[model samples]
Target: MHFKVSNNGTAAVLEPYISMGGHAALLKNDRSVFVHLHPIGTISMASQEKFQENYTQGVLDREDICFFGFADDSTGNYFNSNTSPNGEVNFPAIKLTTPGNYSIWVQVKSAGEVITQKFDFNVIL
Candidate 1:
């Protein structure tokens, strides 16, 4: 897989040359921080699925009502589209609060199998 990284102000923009999939993650080396990323955004698939189920069952109103546990006001509009374009997965900026080493594990699915790539870098204060 080919990946290109560029800086967009404070965020590191990632352009991975592979079909976008779910279950990508970034982690601080000391295990102080971890973020799960999706092709759309940080919102999890299970959460989105639950929101859809609730909305369909009439258990929740479609406007301005937030459910508990990771549900936000934009939950209804979430998962409406994929943020990444063709042949590239765009991740939000990488923000490390402290100066340290970090590793990013990006997973993509191809031919019904999962491929994982590891990238390591350091953050200098």
Candidate 2:
């Protein structure tokens, strides 16, 4: 799942998502599965940065992309949104481990205010 956070209905202010490290949390109603996601993927910022650094340093080549858990073609250009009139922050995909009801809290800070939007979904196999 992905979220497109915009400002004043048109401009997508995604700095918070980046500055906050793309913090998105999920909780199953039965409390069976939980995961924290970043803009790049379901990985910690430290590790993500490390992998990014390695990629830039040439220590890791394109062929070695699979070595990093957070590297994915789908998200390779996740942060490049300059072409879009509204900036956008794309969240990583969320896969439910078990079939059940789940609640997602998509929190983002815009103009110094932290906004939280709650969404519920039922997963069925």
Candidate 3:
């Protein structure tokens, strides 16, 4: 999932651009589970950079999960340096402890405007 910053109602028209540094994400599940994520994902920018460096150096001990590869290319495709961008915002994978409906709110400032989007989903075994 890759989010392309754009103005209201129009997508192809990419917003001039801004840093994702101050973006925020809030997720709630029936008031039971809640989490706040930074623009970099679930961790701070420093932490994300550390992991990226480690991966680049091949210092990770486990091979099950890799959090390294997010790059924007000339084709406006952001991928794992190989995969293609699909226009869906990529959020950190989440684990729900219980089964219920959840709502996610993502807030970001793009082109001097604060944009917020709400998404709802269901969790089932």
On lDDT, the stronger of 2 and 3 is 2
Candidate 1 regions exceeding 4 Å error are: 1-20, 44-46, 54-86
Please list all clashing residue pairs in model 2, or write none if there are none: none
Better of 1 and 3 by TM-score: 1
Q: Report the lDDT tens digits of candidate 2 across residue range 5-123.
A: 67677764544444443466789998888877655466666987897799899886544332112234222333342122234445657667689899888766555566677889999
Alpha carbon deviation, residue 50, candidate 3 (Å):
12
lDDT leader: 2
**Residue runs of model 2 more than 4 Å from their true location after superposition:** 6-8, 17-21, 44-87
lDDT of each: 0.53, 0.58, 0.48
Q: What are the models' TM-scores?
A: 0.54, 0.61, 0.49
Ordering by lDDT: 2, 1, 3
- TM-score, cand. 1 vs. native: 0.54
Pitting candidate 2 against candidate 3, the one with the higher TM-score is: 2
Q: What is the C-alpha RMSD of each candidate to the true structure, in Å?
A: 8.9, 5.6, 7.0
